[model samples]
Structures are given as C-alpha cells and as structure tokens.
Target: MEFTRPLPAYLVTRYHGWKATTYAENHAWYRRLADEGQRPRAMVISCCDSRVHVTSIFGADQGEFFIHRNIANLVPTYEPDGNHHGTSAALEYAVTALKVAHVIVLGHSNCGGVQGCLDMCQGRAPELEETSSFVGRWMDILKPGFEAVKDDPDMPRALEHEAVRVSLRNLMTFPFVKEAVEKGTLSLHGLWTDIGEGGLMHIDRRSGQFTVV
Candidate 1:
C-alpha cells in the first residue's frame, strides 16, 4: 500500500488555527489532560454523520466525553467470537477501563444509515443485501428496528428512534455493562435529535416513547 496523500490544505489551515488560538488559551488544561489521562464521566455513542456534533450539542469541552461514532450508531449484541468488533471494543474500554458512569446513544433525524437500513429491509437496496457489503451487514443489526416501525406513516423518523432503542438493549447484553448497571454504578440514555430544527427528544424507557427535551 502507498501513502502519498497529504492532509487537505483547508484542514491543515484549520488545525493551525485551533492550535494557535484554542490550544494556546487552554495550554495548561491540555497539558493536565495529557499528564493525568482522560476520566470522562460519560461515553457518547453517536452516528458517523458530520452534522451530528455530540460535543457541540452539549457544549462540552475537550476531554469531557469519550465518543464513538459509527454508521446508524448501532451496537451489536455481545459476541465474543474473536472477530473485529470496533463498537464492542469501545464499549468495553469505556465501561471497564474508563469506568464511565453514563453511556448515551445519540440518534438523529435524516440519518443516511437509517435510510439505508430502511431501504434494505424493504428489498429496495439489493446491494446492501449482499454479504460482501460491510455496511449492509452492519445495518442488518437494525432490521428488527425497521420491522417495529415499518407500518408507521413516519417510518424514517420512527426507525431512527428505534435504532437508539435497539442499541440500548444491545448494550445490556455486555456482561460488564450489565453488572455496572445492576450495581448502580452506570446508567444508559437514548436521545434523538432533529437535525433541521435542532430539537432533541429523550427516550422514556418505561413508556418506550421519545418525548421532547
């Protein structure tokens, strides 16, 4: 493999700007973080969508949240089959190593991954049905979510919310996460954001409804 491509000029310029301004102003904080290591109180699992800025949504500073991003923000069930599990790896580290008190799954409207899952479930996305498609396989984790919302008039929005629910349920499958929750050391949260309106909805676990926040 060849590595010839360099960082984009715009990104390089942005990095220099941040390093000079934000980094300079917070020099001591950055150094302390580097020396003491991160001890974020919460772990946010969010979508890979660029518009869904987790830190910005909460107005959090650097080193405040341990975030993991993936398509549809899906979390597969605990499978210790020894295969590569990026999401699972992050969950393990956050729960066991970092001992984060809160685990938040943040979903958003107009999510491409959710749309892809919708299409695949409806038999419209034949490509995603192929085993060779990594994204297709990953989105398969949300098939049940699709089923739960397939009959709804607002399928897209419903599925997006269901995705958060699915991930929350799957998070409990991990033994460590379950233990922490049972011991009252950890909590799980599900949130859905409306991208265009910038409104947020919080899931009520007992009622299984997403109410405005």
Candidate 2:
C-alpha cells in the first residue's frame, strides 16, 4: 500500500506540536480571557486570503478581536433583496450584539480577486456566463474601483486601497453601524498591508494616506 503526502513541512511540524505551539505557555491567559468573556473592542473585516489573518499579524491572542473575512472583503450596502448576506449578518452581530467600538477594514496587495477584476477590465478575462464559476460574481464588488484605477500606473495597489475605503463606507449602511457612529460608540478605520514591502499602512481620513505606522 503506497500513498502520497506532499504537505508543507512546517504545517506537518506545527500539527505534530499543535497544543504546545498554539498555547505556547499562554494557557493561563487564554483560560482567564475565556472566563472573563469576550470584550473585544474591534471587529475586523478582511479578505479570506490566507496571508491576511488579523489575529496572527497583530499578535492578537484569544478573545482579543471579533473578526470576519470574505472574498475581496466587500461589505455590500444593507439590502432586503434576499441575498445570502453572510458578511452583512456577521457585521450586525459584531456591531449590535458584540457592541464593538471600532470596525476596521483590512485590505492588502496582490489580492487575486482584485487582480481578477483588473483582468476583466483589461479584457484578459472574458465576461462569459459561468466563466470562472463564482469568481466573476464575487469580484463584482470591485467593479467601481477597477473603473476608477484602470488608467493609473499604480492601478493594482490603488484599487486594493479603494476596496478598503469602499468597505468602510458600506459599513455605515447598516443601521447599527450608523447609530453607533452617530452616538460616538463606533469608529471606522482602514488599513492596507504589503507582502512584498513588508509594510503596513493605516488610513488617514483627512489626507487619505495609508501611512505606515
């Protein structure tokens, strides 16, 4: 009986030492936080991309953040039109149920979904029905950003940043989000990260600069 296992070595090693690696002497803290209950001050909306984990990147331990991820990290405006609305539902819970103080959208470079929209714009990817299955449907959220940045030299990065900006705006469409902000209970933030440059940028509303901090 011959079988194949070509998984990455690090994954294998980590799994072999799961408990020790995951807790890493933080068992007490994890237990205490678990007992005290989740009082996470923020809910993060980020891409489902593997590299963009908010908890690991920020060194956030258990009970530190309420996180959500989706394709391209889009938060469509509230609608009663019978869509799945998974992201919207999660937003409602994090803001209204959890009463999070800050809602942050985390966008990043080299996003495949963003690049796909760019491909559609440049006429590389066809708009045929059922092509690339759900990808075409999912990337529709970035259509406006594609139109906005397709002419720029920095089209790629700019569109990614635009995604973050748009998501922040969409967050307000939820009544709870709006009320929280109106009453000074909630704030919106945007962030962009670069894997190539090893840089992180936070949004400045006045300047619209994603300055690294």
What TM-score goes with each of the models? 0.98, 0.85
Give the CA lDDT, 0 to 100, for residue 203 in model 2: 92
Off by over 4 Å in 2: 1-16, 21-24, 127-132
38-154 per-residue lDDT for model 1 (tens digits): 999999999999999999999999889999999999999999999999999999999999999999999999999999999999889999999999999999999988888889998
In candidate 2 the C-alpha lDDT for residue 105 amounts to 91
**Backbone clash tally for model 1?**
0
Scored by CA lDDT, what does every candidate get? Answer: 0.96, 0.83
Whole-model alpha-carbon lDDT for candidate 1: 0.96
Give lDDT tens digits, candidate 2, residues 1-213.
258668899997887796676676677888888788788889999999998878867898778789999877788877868878888888988988889999889888899878877787677888622556587876777787777767778878888888887788777888888999999989999998886776889998689878886
Count backbone clashes in candidate 2.
0
